[model samples]
Target: MVKTKVITIASVSGGGKTAVTEELRKRLSTSEALYFDEYDFEGAPDDLVKWVEEGPDYNQWNLEPLKADLESFLEREEPPAYIIIDYPFSYKNDKLKDFIDLSIYIATPLDIAMARRILREHLKKTSIEINDELDYYLKFGRVAYLEMENAIKLNSDFIVAGTLKVIDIVDAILNKIETL
Candidate 1:
């Protein structure tokens, strides 16, 4: 049985990773694509909320559970199973080296990401809560950005310009995967 192809879109908070991942997922959903947000681990939502209300120390805890889930997903035997993962892979873990088939790093200017975050905050119903979250993200996002840069330089298959259209980025990634 052919192993499933896994595509990871990684970047700092406010980067277009989620948007690109969502668009790719929508396009490939008919092909039975499995969408996974690394942050969707047990207690992640609560941690995220806490981080928003308080600060970034919350994420400093272990991420082994999330890594385990990713490893399991990658090891599954299923052909034509496209998994789009939205997460920031910074650490030099064995799992990171093993599971990722194609890693696309979205490179955007910090100001641009901030602007996008502001827009996203405006679109949210809970503006206060979202703003708090955004604030925390904005502060710690820089560190994530640096880590992401290292990760991308070390493992990425491609570094897409963040200004490109989502469709174009998706197409580029799909094309690369097809060749492999």
Candidate 2:
């Protein structure tokens, strides 16, 4: 049986995790990718501030759905050579840590991430909506991003510059994986 290597790319919002995962999947013919945001995980907090204040337990966001999906890939008779995931917590979540063969953190500056998020997600929003989002980021989102980044960065096996082009980031990841 072939062992499918799981590589998780972690980053704050708009920090290139998804982009890297997608590009990596394209480059590796025998690979598939999963995204954390694509699932509605149970136990995820409704309020970001409250969660952060309450110790921001990474496990609080139940990753069972993601886990199940990951298992599906692993359980396949002909498992893909690589399973790339656009995940945020890296190995922080105890439940999912065992399955992760490699964890990568994308260290994007917060300001750049915020700008990208605004442009990508809020471009069609009214000024008031944009302002509201920015206000929320200032008051709560920044802290949450920092919390996740600091925690994940410490646990990741590799770190990449989020400012790099997606292809460059993917190349770095591929080179790192090849060395392993």
Candidate 3:
């Protein structure tokens, strides 16, 4: 049986975690990729400002569904050699920490991430809606993003520049994994 290593890629919103995870999966023949956005996690904060003000606890979000799915994937007769996840919490969440063999944090600049997010996710929205969202981001969301990044980066085994090309990022991650 191949020993599967769980590798998690963490980054702020629009920091290319998903892109890197997908590209890495394609390059690694015996790998599976999981995305956090695919699951509706319980205890996820609805108000970022409030959450941060309350002294954010990354473990507050229950990741049981993700954990369950991960276990099921690993139970396959021919389990993957690597399990890559585009997760936000890195090893900060107690429930998922033990399963992580390697934690990677993408250090993306706030401005760059915000630009990417606005261009990618808000194109369909009206101008007023986009403005309102940006206003909110400026007011409260930035704090949450910064806090999350700091926490994850502190615990991560590796840090990749989010400004790198997707292929380059994947190369870096693969190289890091090889060293491990």
Ranking by TM-score: 2, 3, 1
| Candidate 2 per-residue lDDT over residues 1-180, each given as its tens digit | 657889999988889888888899999879999999899989999998778877878888889999999999888889999999999888889889999999999999989999999899987899999999999888877888888677888889999998899889889999999976
User: In candidate 3, what are the lDDT values of residues 1-180, reduced to their tens digit?
Assistant: 558999999999989999999999999988898999999989998986799889988789999999998998789999899999999888888999999999999899988999999999887899999999999998878888888676778889999998899999989999999987
Residue-wise lDDT of candidate 1 within 1-180, one digit each (tens)?
556666777766677888888888877743323334534444443444445445334245455666666566665564346777775653234445466677778877766777786776567558677777667766654555555555453566777777777788778777776776
Over 4 Å off in model 3, which ranges?
none
lDDT of each: 0.63, 0.89, 0.90
List the pairs of residues colliding in candidate 3.
none
Off by over 4 Å in 2: none
The TM-score values for the models, in the order shown, are 0.65, 0.96, 0.96
lDDT of 2 at 42: 93
Scanning candidate 2 in windows of ten residues, the lowest lDDT window is 141-150
Evaluate model 3: give its lDDT: 0.90
Clashing pairs in 2: none
